[model samples]
Target: MSELFDRHQAVLPKWLAIYYSDPLEITHGEGRYVWGADGRRYLDFFGGILTTMTAHALPEVTKAIAEQAGKILHTSTVYLSRPMVELAEQVAELSGIPDARVFFTPSGTEANDAALLLATAYRGSNQILAMRNSYHGRSFSAVGITGNKGWAPTSLSPLKTLYVHGGMRSRGPFAHLPDDEFIAACVADLEDVLGQTRPGVAALIAEPVQGIGGFTSPPDGLYAAFREVLDRHGILWIADEVQTGWGRTGDHFWGWQAHAENGPPDLMTFAKGIGNGMSIGGVVARAEIMNCLDSNSISTFGGSPVTMAAGLANVAYLLENDLQGNARQVGGRLIERLRSGCAGLPGVREVRGRGLMIGIELVKPGTDEADPEGAAAVLEAAREGGLLIGKGGGHNTSALRVTPPLSLTQEEADEGAEILLRALGGG
Candidate 1:
């Protein structure tokens, strides 16, 4: 083991998971590549779970940060911040919620926490509905709504959460059903669960693509159908877009747009990519719900000028360059390439996800049992081949996660896929 690894184990909590058995220390990054401390260059497919939305070392974001730092690094939320208001206006416009208001946080966990607070307070209930196999965040409130057992370290929660089905399509009771039938089954199940809950269930929170649950997602319009039921009960719908937002999905700017027929969600939380590796996360809600809180609250570092500056520049670059369009064109090709390449591999179970956020599920050769060992081996082999990937699942860690920066190119995609294919024993 390396000295740093030994020291990490000695000082850090054992539960703070590290990626590889021999963990990596990435010191610097440029474009789609990041360098380990020992000077090994690796193609970064996961991009810190898709936090680096645009290319690394993009001059626009770096310059913005530098300029803002030169002026003032931080000013707490008590005073009006120009960059923060500008960013809020842009996000509020993109949010699609009528009369939208935005609240910033330093990370997605706090963003989701704030969303929960607004929702529960507005409806006067601590009851929340979540999806099975979903992973929200690590906070006490966020984990309470998270359905993945491996990520939830605590059973004690402030809110009463109900776990509903339909996040995973590979092995659920509805898995064998056709698309329409599957949607019906999940809706039926959701209705059944809501039937048992008390009158004041606040909201049904979901990740359009379940990030740490291995990028599992339901068919399009599934949430729209659920929205109908939620509307009947006056329960709000909160979309957690931490790993799925900001055009990563290619076809849409927000994952909930996949279910546009029912209109925008009552609340939405986003992070990871908005600030292009800067610490930025936020919640957007209609004015009515956002103003429900009676007490005054502030986020000291949430919308600080520096982070907001990064957000503004990053967003401008994304829009000006049409990186979402790039994700659509290149991501489509990459997924098809992976699906076609891994089709005959006995250890491969399914290739799933939309646009830049993709997952390859590993299974036993002829059975549906999760092959976490196989996934781990593939990850290691990919690293040896000068590529970096990630592993995640509901509890088994049986899936390979591919969430590259939105600026990924056709060449990078092809290169990463070739390395991944070799690692998976396909080449």
Candidate 2:
């Protein structure tokens, strides 16, 4: 480790994981590339874990933030703010929830916490149903609902959370079953879990595509089937869209739309990519659910003028340019290329994803056993080839996460795939 890495370790918590055997300090970024402190430019495929929604250093977003900062940075959530209102209006319209209300927070962790608060309060229960191998956030309440053990440091929580099966379809009990039978089995599992729980179950929260759990997901309409059961008990469905939102999935604007059979989610939490790198997260809920809390609450730095301005500009750019269509077109090509390139690689187990949020799982050669070390080796090789990537999975970070900015072009996609293939030692 360099002096900077050594200093980072001295100051930061050990649990805050850093990538690679050696760490690089990224100083600046433009478009699809970022320069390290050593001044080497590397293609940014992960986009700061998909926080950079449109592009890096986008002129429109930068100008909006600068202009807003010049006027007023923040006025808290108490008094009215124009930029806040504008962004809120846009988000509410796109939320797909009827009579939707938006409350901004600083990060996805806080957004999930707020959703939990609202659901528990509205439904009058402290019990929550969460999907196994799922990850929400790092906060106390968020960790409580999170089912991924690697992310959850402590078991203590205010709510009673029960883990449900069928979140990750690849390595679960129903992985071998057909799509219809898999959904049925998962629904049956959910019914059994519900039967074991008390009547105080407030809501069931899920990630349409499990982000930190290696981008794994169950079949389409699985949640809709689960929704059928939750409806009988009045359990609200909360879609955690921290990673799956903003049309990154290609086919849908929101991840929950994959299960559109039961209609929109009762509550949805969004963060990460909305501000295009700024701290902006929020919960969208129907009027009655949002207005359930009787007392006043506020996020001290949430929805500030600067972040809201950035969000407005970023969202506008995303829509006007039709980046979602770009994701569908370019992402489809990239995944196809990857699938073709890594066909017989020894460690490569599966290549799966929708749109730009793709994952390539690695196993111990021909066995089903996870190979985290192999995944790490591939990461190191990709870095040497000047391509940046991320890794995550339920089994010790055993998969590569390839979530570039939604504005990723075909040429860039091909370049990244070539580098990744070389790193995997594929010919």
TM-score of 1: 0.99
User: C-alpha displacement of 183 in model 1, angstroms?
Assistant: 0.8
lDDT of each: 0.93, 0.93
Model 2, TM vs. native: 0.99
Candidate 1: which stretches are off by over 4 Å? none
lDDT of 1: 0.93
Q: Which 10-residue span in candidate 1 carries the lowest summed lDDT?
A: 164-173
Q: All candidates' TM-scores?
A: 0.99, 0.99
Candidate 1, residue 296: lDDT: 91
Q: Write the per-residue lDDT of candidate 2 for residues 199-261, one digit (tens) a residue.
A: 969999999999999999999999999999999999999999999999999988999999989
Kindly list the per-residue Cα lDDT of model 1 for residues 277-393, writing each as its tens digit. Answer: 999999999999999999999999999899999999999999999998999989999999999999999999999988999999999999889999999999999999999989899
**lDDT score for candidate 2 against the true structure:** 0.93
